[model samples]
Target: MLSIIVAVAENNVIGKDNGLIWKLPRDMKHFKETTTGHYIIMGRKTFESNGRPLPNRTNVIITRDKNYKAEGCVIVHSLEDAIKEAKNDSEAFIIGGGVIYDLSMPLVDRIYLTKIRHTFEGDTLFPELNMDNWNITEKRDFEPDEKNEYPFTILTLDKKK
Candidate 1:
């Protein structure tokens, strides 16, 4: 299964200056839980923002630079090549940065979204999802705590038949 995992605000913002806008630790933990041990495909910028390869998972970085390399991660020239590398995995995750998210949106079979309740001013935004093409398979709301600034909902969407 190909899946897209991201946290989006009410305005569809996902990042600012190549970094995440929110500082929700719970959301981060959820992300780690979902993508751990899966093939994670992301663009170069996203990989850089993460600082290092995620542990216990296959990190596939998609970059146009033929000579680009990141230690402990697989570098691929295109999204297709990244997907091909992940073909044998039971589930591969498309982790973000806007461009990769947009390109993978149509190709993913599932979406694991953390829907933040507030809007944020951000340069990067997630592609608008068409509800007609997806069905919510699961949903759980989280109330804001001392550690988290905003209330959020985790929604799992499956491609509609």
Candidate 2:
């Protein structure tokens, strides 16, 4: 299965200045737990923002430029390459910046979304999802915590086959 994982603010903002706008620990844990041991594919911008490979997962970065290279990451010039690399695995996670997310959405089998309750001003946004094409298979709401500024929910959607 191809799973696309993304965290969005209430207004659908995914990032600011090519980096995440919020630092929610629980959300971080959720991402780590769900994507561990699977391939994590992202765009070059997102990979650069992270500064290093996420542990225990195959890191794949999509870039249009052929010369880009980073330690411990498999760089590809296209989505086709990313998909080809991920085919050996049972599932792979597309963890992204806007460009990669937009390109991969149609090819993914499932979507793992962290929906934050509050909106923030941001420069980047998640792609618009077509609810008619997806079925929500799982959803769990998280209550506000002392450290978390906003409540959030984990939403898993499977594409209608």
Candidate 3:
């Protein structure tokens, strides 16, 4: 299964200055817990933002740069190629930087969205999802704590059959 995982603010903003705008530790934990041991397909910029390939999972970077090379990462020229690289996995995740999200939105079977209950100033935004095409299969709400900066909700949405 191909899944898109993201954290967006109330205003749909996901990042600014090529990095995440907020620090939500719980959300980070959730992302790690869910995506661990799976193939993580992401855009080149997203990989750069993260600085390196995450351990324990296969890292597939999608980039237009034919000569692009990231040690320990499988580099592909397109999102389709990235998907193809991760085809054997039971579940592969598309970890985005806006463009990759947009490209994979229609092709993914599921979405794991973290809805942060605050607005942010950002250049990158999550695409508006049409509720009609999805069904909420699971949801968990969390309140802000000393470790986490904002209140948020984690939702697992499956494409409608």
Candidate 4:
């Protein structure tokens, strides 16, 4: 199954200037815990933003240009190719910047969301999730930490069909 792991602010902001907005340590921990052993797919820009590959996971980056390549990352020209590569894995994670999330949402089976209670001014956002098509299977609220500017909630949703 395909899973999308994202941390979103109250207004749905996921990033700004190709970087993450919030520095929630717990949320970061959640991300690492959930995607550690999975195949993680992201856009070329997202890969660049990180400066390096995340450890303990297979990093696949999607780019339109066939010539583009990054060290230790599998580069593909389309989402179809990425999915094909991850087909044998029990779960493949769509970890992203805006464009990748928008493109991969429809093909995913579940989502792990960290929803911050504060809105941030940002240039990028998480894709709009269709509530009707997803069922919230788990939810847990977390108190604001020194690193996080406001309260947040962790939610896990599975596709209805």
Q: After superposition, how far is residue 18 of candidate 4 from its true place, in Å?
A: 0.9
lDDT of 1 by residue, 1-161 (tens): 89999999999999999898789999989999998989999999999999999999999999999999899999999999999999999999999889999999989999999999999999999999999999999999999999998999999999997
TM-score of each: 0.98, 0.97, 0.99, 0.96
Each prediction's RMSD to truth = 0.6, 0.8, 0.5, 1.0
Question: Per-residue lDDT for 14-52 in model 3, tens only?
Answer: 999889899988898999999999999998989999999
List candidate 3 segments past 4 Å from native: none
CA lDDT for candidate 1: 0.95
How well does model 2 score by local distance difference test? 0.92
Model 4, span 1-161: residue lDDT tens: 99899999888998898888778888888999999988999998999899899999999999999789788888999999999999999999999979989988988899998889889999998878879999999999999767766789999999997
Question: Lowest-scoring 10 consecutive residues by lDDT in candidate 2?
Answer: 142-151
Cα error, candidate 4, residue 134 (Å): 1.0
lDDT of each: 0.95, 0.92, 0.95, 0.90
Model 1 regions more than 4 Å off: none
Which residue pairs collide, candidate 2? none
Report clash pairs, candidate 4.
none
In model 4, the Cα lDDT at residue 101 comes to 90
Which stretches in model 4 have alpha-carbon errors above 4 Å? none
